[model samples]
Target: MKRRKFIKKSLIGGAAITMPFVLPSGRLFASSGNRMADHVVFVAFAGGVRQQESVLQRYLDDSQAYPSAGNIMYNILDGAPPTDKIVYGTTNYVNGDTPIPKMLSQTLQQQGTFFKEVNASVVGHYAGVNTLLTGNYMFTQGLRNKPLTPTIFEYLRRLTGEKATKTWFIGNGIGNSIPLLDYSTHSDYGAQYGANFLAPIVTFGNSGDKHLKNAKVYHPEEELDPMYKMKYFLDNVWYSQGSALPNIGNTEEEKLEIKQFVRDMFQKKDNGSIAFPPISDSGDLQTIGYACEVLKRFKPTLTVIYLSNVDGCHGNFSSYLRSLHRADHGVGHLWDFIQNQVPEMSGNTTMIVAPEHGRNDDPNGIKDANAFYGYDHSDSNSQRIFNMMVGPGIDSNLSIGNENNKVGDIVNIAPTIAEILGFKNDIVNTGLLASNQSFFDLI
Candidate 1:
């Protein structure tokens, strides 16, 4: 109930915003993917995040200081605590004001291999989520009439050798449905659709889905018992929507193939298995829990996890201590698990954590009449996001690069992953494809 109101009030007028941050032009990487980043593990705030709450920020006006992110040691597993505040940069937090800053230059500098300038033109949750997940984006009004493009999961399958069969979109606030890039019905899946462009097997959930713990204990060879059925009816609902549409394409064979694919997906809905909850837009606790589960049990070679609690707490601008603490803790756990629990995950994995976008915060919402608008990220493309990188092949402490004010826009992520996976796709999506070579040093 509160969330619906939140969305309604936060909705911006007109079309959704689209900002593309492309990589700097030049040959920076001598090579790609260091020893530690042999594999890829991506963690993101499913929803948009203001820089104030995360690792980096772009500053224009006065910013506030909350808590400093403990240096790497402070976050070390069971390491000695720092006696003083682990201040990386200065903050000037005031009561009732948005806790975020208009600019976070210091945070940007300290943020190892992070992007300083990134933007999310849209303010709505769905638009931001779509933009972040898929390189393609739609502005506020355009989104209502149009559809988004394929996401990382889809790209991973089509371009890279990686299969969507093992992929997961855990705890999706919105039920999993592949976004459609083809604008018109003719270009889109059309009326007779098989499997309807794309679909993931099972969505991992949180407390509601307790199957994770049990799955961990059970051997992989063991057959999932009687209760583990994935109701084909649910998947068919999606297929039915596709099938019921009029034949979209000019050709008959294509139409038949489309319908056939959708039917096959329905029949095989129960085939794959995962145990995390569908993530909630409200916060990040469940996301942390899910990441821990993946690290402990199902360590898919290519994975993407969403963390948004920081965004939530910051948006409210009350006491975000809990949100920051949780984000820091969650990040620590993931890193620790990679090194300790899943030793193989260390050098073999490349971890990328980036926020959807930045915000305009200073901790005191009541300070002005503009409190409501103060809670969100600005439209300025020069400064509105942050990115973090770490892994076997990466340098311990580093910044993104020094070519452009921005490293790349939201569109570059898929290609970055594809590069790490050693896959090459000549055709690309919106904006220029950001090269993955920048990841070499951070590995």
Candidate 2:
């Protein structure tokens, strides 16, 4: 947290890699500060959902020919799913699939607060996520690099003395610099304070099963070839397309604890004891399952899970709707798991859900298998988004803002989370997100 010890440099592969705040004193900060909640789970409900299709229009009836026009997302919003469309993985189907039962008795909005129309900083996927996490709009940020500003994870760890094991970013998949968002390249806060990111599908599915499912330790002198092969595989596949390794920002003991957690997770997966809810086949649902596992095991202080199947909107409108609906279902299951299963984090955790950006108001001229028009986020409508939060310290059943009176910004999110964890001022004092106000303050 000290400003003077910022901006340190290091070398990697004979190239000057500047890693800031490497001093021992820089690793620990104001641990004495008060906290609003014991834990936070941030869902980057990503891949650009259009407001017209989501909070604003509520087009289930119109788009899917349902009997009712109310909310189809029964878990997150106070409404029912499209009873007739039945394409969004509902177990209740007439000729094909039956109606999938509701996951929760109470909706997330009924138990928490809702921001109907939050403003996003940018329309691009990576930039929108960057704004949400960093509390700053990186106008010049490329699609391939990490954010220039420090993320809330770095601020939370550096300002609160939270261990690396207490923070994690469970990604749906590693693409479009999604892995890079776990940390930042800021001078005062970098990998030393980054979150541990894991892509469950890539790490625990087919590739993981091949590479690490039953990985065993090797003796250095006896198995040099095997060791080199393992190292080569890790370097080539794990870091492919500019992806960084699992930059575990932890002490030696904490690192070992994380490794053990991963091993145990693999065992549970193999033994079919994960206790996941009955869910349809979707990447987002799979990611949420792993996220629940992480919560059950580690109960990390800050965990962010990203869902991106909705990006199918770019080429398939029908699939986009299905993905959005399934994403909501997955989210509902995750929240339910936290409340009913994770006893250690049940009542004390806060959950924040928001998309990276909104989709285009018009079609992109692409037709899908269903003959539905495809869309890409581009116009002003793409900038309109929303944020929902439920947990301790947040007002329940409260709705803020509307179409005519739009409030909140993507930048406000990071500061709001910082304030929830009692470090808004500390993060602002660092001059990283000085201009952004906490969403609580805005309301």
Candidate 3:
């Protein structure tokens, strides 16, 4: 009854604020197999990527005025740039806005295992990403709704007995069902095993900047003003109407730690102590910076970073090219930070990246400033996406699939991540996984 009251009173404007952090009893599906890596970073790469442009390294050949192609995504793969009609928004264009050079020498393809073609069964963004996290094709899952099955976060936390601090989903933004993917609605593994979700830009920008910045602790009865202010703030801003969003299952101690981290981040942002790639305005890059901060502070076992700037392909092709290149730049910086700054996670962590789905076969007739046609996603082009993994135990300079064949499914990524983090058997035995196969087994 006390728990019910706590939830009931916290419900303001139809949204339930996060209850005080606590852990439920017992592990659900404890793992018996040996863990492969100490940590896992799953880059959702949300917003479908196209094959001809991304893995195949074709820049503008498919949907632009130029018939030439080049490797704009230099960090993810090893390929050459387009020699003629180079109008994919490069500073190399001589009249471009920002002169950003492509980092080509030591690409992820050179250092990691790259899958040229991974099948993303679902074409829609919400369903595709849900498929990536749940290892099942969720045809029933819809926009702005929580997943219908257990996410990888729930699997890792429940099976490994890891605390909320050790599992995180750092999203780029809160749109569609992005925020809901942190946890699922499954009866067996639900809110109690969900990951710590921090939409840094969203939280820090609006309410946090005003309420949390340099704020002191307050007693409930002694300082009711601040409490009510916070209540109103959370209810009005953080959550939507009539939505009882699940909270990240952290212990009280972990909650305090996260609070401290947030305070420190605010201070760092003000003092310019936050380390980011110099002079970049992309939201994904900013999110990556905060994700790095979380890794440095908490050293989580699994961290999923979602990047969706590439979704600009829906309208502006030139901006899409720019965003895609900048996304690679952000990813490269993140890997570098892990290697140099976060010493504990430096050598032991495994990083796996794949898009939620791929773009359509042809343009949607939306042209950019450069006369380049923008593309969309559907069942037609969603069949082929790419996957890349780099870390200890993963094969280096290995490329799976080719022009003649497709290799993996987007659903396979979750099981593969589970296998990497020592919970493959547990996840597979749950009967939740579809027809996806782990990379470990494939290799």
lDDT values for all models: 0.42, 0.79, 0.80
Candidate structures ordered by TM-score, highest first: 3, 2, 1
- Cα lDDT of candidate 2 equals 0.79
Query: In angstroms, what RMSD does candidate 2 have relative to the true structure?
Result: 8.9
How many steric overlaps are in each model, in order?
63, 9, 1
Q: By descending lDDT, how would the candidates be arranged? A: 3, 2, 1
Best by the TM-score measure: 3
Model 1: number of clashes? 63
Question: In model 2, what lDDT does residue 348 have?
Answer: 86
lDDT of candidate 2 over 1-443, digit per residue (tens): 44433433222522443334343526433554577888899999999998866785455444333344545456777765445444455445332234446787888888988998988869998888888788898898888898898888888888877888888888989997899998888877788888988898898888888888777754545675576678878788766667775454576567556677777878988898765657747788889988998899888999989889999999987678777777888889888899899999899889999998998777788986655677898898898999999989888899999888788888888888887788777787788783658778866
Error of 2 at 117 (Å): 0.3
TM-score of 3: 0.85
lDDT of 1: 0.42
Mark the 10 consecutive residues where model 3 has the least summed lDDT. 16-25
Weakest 10 consecutive residues of candidate 2 by summed lDDT = 5-14
lDDT of 1 by residue, 323-364 (tens): 543454455556655665676576577667665655554433
Each model's TM-score, in the order given? 0.54, 0.84, 0.85
- In candidate 3, list every pair of residues with a backbone clash: 70-82
